[model samples]
Target: MSNLTTLLALADSRLPTGGHVHSGGIEEAVTSGLVVDLASLRAFLVRRIRTTGLVCASLAVAVHRGALSASAGESGDLETDARTPSPAARQASRAQGRGLVRLGRRIWSDEDWDALGPTPHLAVAAGVVGRAGRLADQHTALSVVYTTMTGSATAAQRLLALDPGDVAALTFDLSALCEQTAAEAAKDVTDLSDPLLDVLAQRHVERDRPLFAS
Candidate 1:
């Protein structure tokens, strides 16, 4: 398959990465009334892309570029752990990372996979997968940024029973921002934090019967 095809496959929500069960903190946002309608959802997505999205994309790019390696003990996983303040968010990320690593191992035969340890962070796993797949740094960054928005948007749509057409349009409208953020991320790793997101993630874990993991 072509690189584009592989990238698309990796970005697919149906990739069996256990991604469907997590709402990227949107569940808590909705429960807290921080995001109710299309307008608020858009704002939430925008903020997410600027904060966690950028950090994730940059980490992926850095890993893809060989600037950080799990084997060399310069793992981006540590950085990811430090940047992610919420234990819930960290657990969610590692769960997804394990899924990605499982799929990646089945597809590629590389020793680098062992370097990732048992549970790499999602961004670190993404970078390793991108490198193993021979995808461009920009492509890896774009994938990270794109998923950062789409995953939460999808959860919001289901939770709110939102019009799919409206949600699709919203994602389409944010494509430019995704591209710009990816481009910036490909240039360098970034450190950004969102305290509200952290709080929501923590709160989500405490919910009696949460719809999503985080």
Candidate 2:
């Protein structure tokens, strides 16, 4: 397949990675009343892109930079896991990683998924898939950032019944920011953390009536 085709497939929400079920923490944020409208949702997304979004993009770039060996790949996964302080966040990452790897194996039959070991982080899975599919590091990073934004945006619309056009506009405003963040992430894999997001994930997991698995 061509690079564009591969990227489109990977970015498709229909890829069945269980990404749709999780709101990227938006559900928890809504439950906590942190995001009740377009303005708050935009703020949440911007913070997310700068923190975990950038971190995930960096890890994906690291993988594309030739950390393909078993040990090196595991190191990359560990690095991402360390930045995620919440147990719920780790579980969600691993779940998405497993889903992506499962789909990736079917697409790129030659690559060895076993080397990534059990419960690879989502960033590691994206990197492996991106490398195998010949996607550029920029595209990989942007896709991660894009999904990070869209997942929560979609969730907010559902949870708050916000205007779809307004939600879309909010995401549109972040295009340049996402590009800039992706470029910076490609340059260095910083250990950035969002404590509030971690706390939200922990709370989400402990809820008796959780809306999302994250």
Candidate 3:
């Protein structure tokens, strides 16, 4: 919790970088009738929080952990990130990721900031700050989980006709999964592979979407 204030503030929906425009497939999923109720949303979000959050946490630690490097963990994390099945999902990630890093540089302390041009991906931004904040595996994991969950929930406010209270409740539920995924990522990874996510992401490039630009 070393940089809790920064983490919470930047992650807040109010900060706004077009995050509301995307739903992480919740819009498409619900529109496609794949998700409709809180129960379904919960299930969808759980799988999402677990897989996506774990990837974010794993990559954050991997890219920055140095001596405690997690190359194997990164391979697994990248596997899922690359496995996103829908074009919208992949574009949504890259689009929001760009916004995350772009905004991060404008507001975050530049002293430690990398002049690496753009963030390239959201995980990079999360990892950079996660390392600075002294967040362990669990905390780091939850941050990314909540980030994606909240972003999707925010979009869901309109996408699913969900109430504000329900959104908050769903976010709370997602918190646990983030922690769980983080714990898994914290452990040594025996093997790493993820193709489904990548395939979906590649397809996302072909789809025509208004919200997220892949």
Candidate 4:
């Protein structure tokens, strides 16, 4: 497949990576009344994209650029853990990572799959997949950042019965910010943290009947 096609396939929400089930803390945000309408949702997404999103994209870029590996010690996974303060968020990331690793191993041949262990962080897995797919660092970063935004936005749409058109427009309007974040992420690894997201992730785990995993 072409490079663009490969990137699209990896970024597709229907990739069976278990990404659809996780809201990236949006469910908890909604329950907590932090995000109610389109305006609030946009604010939430902007904060997310600037913080965890940048961190994820940067880690993926580091892996894709050969600056980091998926190994346990001194690897991208540890960095991911350090950047992610909540245990629930870490678990969710590993769950998605396992799915990505499973799919990636079936589709691509790479020794990094074995090195990634049974449960790598999502960003580390994404980087390995990007490298194996021969994708550019920028493409990899963009893919990570895009998914980071879309996953939560999708969950909010479902939870609030939001107009799909408005949701689509909201994401489209933020495309430039996503691109800018991805560009910066591709340049270096980041340790940005979002305490509210971390708290929300933990709270989501405690919800009696949560819609999303995290």
RMSD of each: 1.2, 1.7, 4.5, 1.0
Show the lowest summed lDDT stretch of 10 residues, model 2. Answer: 65-74
Write the number of the candidate with greater lDDT, choosing between 3 and 4: 4
Q: Judging by lDDT, tell me the better candidate of 2 and 4.
A: 4
Compared with the true structure, all predictions reach lDDT values of: 0.90, 0.83, 0.57, 0.91
* lDDT (10s digit) by residue, model 1, range 35-142: 999999999999999999999889989888989875524668888888899998999988988888899988887646887888788999999889888899999999
Name the regions of candidate 4 deviating beyond 4 angstroms. none
Q: What TM-score does structure 4 among the candidates reach?
A: 0.97
RMSD of 1: 1.2
Q: Write one digit per residue (lDDT tens) for candidate 2, span 1-214.
A: 9999887777676778888888888998998889877888889999999988999888888887775332335577778878898889988988888888888888788998888877688888888888898989888887788787787788889889988888888888998998898888888777889999999988898889877787
lDDT of 4: 0.91
If both were scored by TM-score, which would come out higher, candidate 3 or candidate 4? 4
| Backbone clash count for every predicted candidate, in the order shown | 1, 0, 9, 1
In order of appearance, the predictions have TM-scores of: 0.97, 0.94, 0.73, 0.97
Candidate 2 residue 14 C-alpha distance from true site, Å: 2.2
List ranges where model 2 is wrong by over 4 Å. 68-73
lDDT of 3 by residue, 90-134 (tens): 556556656766665665555245432342445555555566556
Instruction: Please list all clashing residue pairs in model 2, or write none if there are none.
Output: none
State residue 11's C-alpha deviation in candidate 3, in Å: 3.5
